[model samples]
Target: MQCDICQRSPSSRLPFNCTLCARNTLYQPRIQLAQSLLQKEALEKEVDQNVAGTPKPTRIIPAPGGKPSEPNPSWIVQRAAAEQIVSEEKTQGIHDHVKTLREEIQNTKAEIAARKARLQKRRSEFASAKQELSKSQTGAVENMDKSMRRTEHRWDILHNKTAESRLFLCREAALLYGLHQRKRKKGGLGRDVYFVGGVPIADLRDLNSMDSFDYGLRQADSSIDASPAHVTTSNTNLAHLVHLVSHYLSLRLPAEITLPHRDYPLPTILSPGSSYTGREVPFPGSTPSHSSNNSPSASRHADQRSLPRPRPLHLDKKLSALAKDDQVAYASFVEGIAFLAWDIAWLCKTQGLNVGGNSWEDVCAMGKNLWQLLLAPPPRPSVSREPSSKTPPQKPSLSRPSTAAARTLQPENPKDVPPLGHFSHGTAYGYLATASGTEYMRDWGLQHPLRVIEKVKAMLLAERTGAEWEILEGNEWEEEEAGSEAKKETKKDVVRPGIEETVILVRPGGVESGINEGSGGTEREESDGKGRGASGWMKLKSR
Candidate 1:
């Protein structure tokens, strides 16, 4: 029998078992090989069955009534399902994106509308504010214009009248000075004295300096030979020069006096609306009655309440910043002018004579000096107003013989014309040139300088008396309450008239005659009492 354990015949008989030695190696090899071959054959048979079975044609299922249909593969069904799921997800995502976009668009529209509303509101508010500002500015401009016109009118009246009277006073002073100088000199010069304008145009240096004494003497001597044209030309030139000086003086003098310092404000003349009454110049021998209830400072404040606030020229600020030397020079120059004006004013009241047409500048230029104008004899009677050659008339000349040429040069009937002392016109109007300078003087009523001075004096006196309420009405404090009873009580408070009763009267024309009357009385009393009295007017002149 063929052995199963070994492929070859068993070398050792063991009844289908290999020999013990060959059992492991040979027998085991044979058995494994046979089993492997059998398993390979079986696998091939199974594979063949599966391949051959799939060859079974795809089944065509008949539809209920018509055409046959092919069954779909499972994978294709799954793929379709997956594709559907993906498409659904994509659609959902697209929808969500579109919704978010719509929401963003709606939010943008709402934001745009809100911004536009805010911008419109702001623009309207700006326009309203701008309109209000324009209205306010226009109103302010109108008010300022009205105030300026009123102030200017007041200034014109006050300044022009004051200047006119003051000029007259100054002329009077020059005459006085001239008389005094003449008194000092024992005898009058050989030349006859005559007056032209306010100047004593004599050959003496004491009376005039512009022309040398020799030249003036020669001219007076040659009056007998001089032509009318020469005399007229000379007088015209003199008048013109005097006019120029006065014009410049008016502008400069006030500026110096009215400019504010760090410590002091402008005076009332320059600042009409200002309520600042300057340092109260007390009346002579008039001590302010001090009370236990009121201190000096308190009284001053009370007095200040009646006055306007002082306005100063802003130009002083520049001076304050200047060097010390410059400041001192400026101050001295201003003081010099003020002092000169004061001196000239003083001479007028003391002299008792008024020199018409003569101004401060005229006195300075035409006169030798203040002493000379006061002391020297009157100017030689000459051609003050020369006549034309056709109708020349003769006037006697002290210096030379009467000739036809001299007669023509001399004024016709010198005594027939009013004397300088007789003419009392204010300097501003006394000369044609000075009158030109005061174009602003039109419509201004005449006022006495002394009257204005007296008013200032009374105001000061009132202040010193601690009666501020008396000087300017409506300046005093009253206890006002809200109730009707308080009003009745306030009404019961009567105004007591005192020294200041006439103070207000002094400013207006109503009391001008009265002021003159009072002043005349005061002057007579002063003149009779102490030989030289320092009345309020005199005191102001002294200042």
Candidate 2:
């Protein structure tokens, strides 16, 4: 059964609390992490010890001062000092007899020197002739050229290794993402949906829109969803955001926003890969393989002798999926990507979380950022509301557009509002239309560790103020305390026929029925302050 607060299946085994509840209730996840880290460290050590030809140090004994001396001296020391001295004196007499032999050798050496001087004169002439024959240019320049080539070769090898390792990491991250996607379809470990500030959101929706988000739901072809799913269009939701943040702040998406460079920047478009280096040895029986086959595809690319050749720009394999977009979109994607990377860096260092490999770190980290993105408030509305924007609030109850300042949450003129306001008409009710279409928020189970619904709900419900108190309640009976609660139940009937009925996943504080049942709309058209009695959007004070 789902926990009332987090609405997740808690782990029931002895000594094991529910992982969902554990996350909500506990501040640290140390024990499980410590065990995993210890295991990895052991594996690394085992690998290190198995490598071949590692050297071992030598052992030695010490001497008093001089190093080890002659073995005969050691024996002599063992004998009595007088006996050793007498033996040495007898040897000296033999040495005097050898002195006569030395004199005779000196006389022979003098004769030999005279003959050698004549031989040396002949050798000198031949040596000079040989030097003339081999007058090669063996100068400092040649030595410098050789050293430089070696350095360049080493640089190339290092570069290729670094690039390949990075590519492997990116590929791994993509694979991990794919696994999470499949698990979500099978409903294995449900980390897809999570709540933040009490609002439920799906990570897949952030990555992909709603129509494409549903998977495990009933389908006609398979068992997922027997009938075609009815989904609200994304435009209306965009309208609701305009009502909530932009309309108030009057901000809009800027003409442009400055973006930072990539998490790992690529090289110049014109330059070839770093200078080539060390060759790869052939595998086992392939000893005949080329000596320099080690470099990656990018560096090994040949036939580019022409000037300013175009280079193939490949991203790290893990990051390659992101490399497909056009410049502007690529730039936009990176902003979110960089933010995710920063978050991972923080978690790995501060939380002591075991991130495992580069791929795991990248995907999970991206999921983390995607999870928080829901809390990122919309930009204020534009200087002038776009034609597509909610019609100037007048006649708002109907679908008709008006040129006047439509009655909205603000102090709208009677002229601003039509006699028949768009209570459920126009795009004004888009948020309600949106809330009804929460399937878009379900994809989080596939991409994150926390189920999407729980995370979003927490963000929306955790610190409910007087305004949000009713929406966060666990049951329908208790939700009536909110002033707007009455209208919420009434509004459930307002949904167009064939759309799914109200089903809110209460979290953090408790389970909730329909959000509308307890949390009624502000009477936006008539509201004086930020509160619009029936139409204004609710906002997080915590943000």
Q: Which candidate number maximizes TM-score?
A: 1
lDDT of 1 by residue, 156-203 (tens): 565455543444443343332221111112242233233333223322
Q: What local lDDT score does residue 105 receive in model 1, on the 0 to 100 scale?
A: 96
Per-residue C-alpha lDDT of model 2 across residues 1-543, encoded as one tens digit per residue: 556754555454434345656654453466556656755665444334323222122122223232422223433344446455767887887787688678778878987997799789878977886675444435455777798889878765554443333223322322222212112233222333322121222232233212122332211122231111121111112213212322222222111111113421222121112112122212112222333465677446733342222121222221212333343333333333232233322222111122222232223322333222212101211112112222222111212112121111112232322111111112332121254323322221223322322333243233233233212323443453353445545644544434443433322223334334444322211111111111122221211
Off by over 4 Å in 2: 1-138, 177-467, 470-543
Which lDDT values do the candidates have, in the order given?
0.34, 0.30
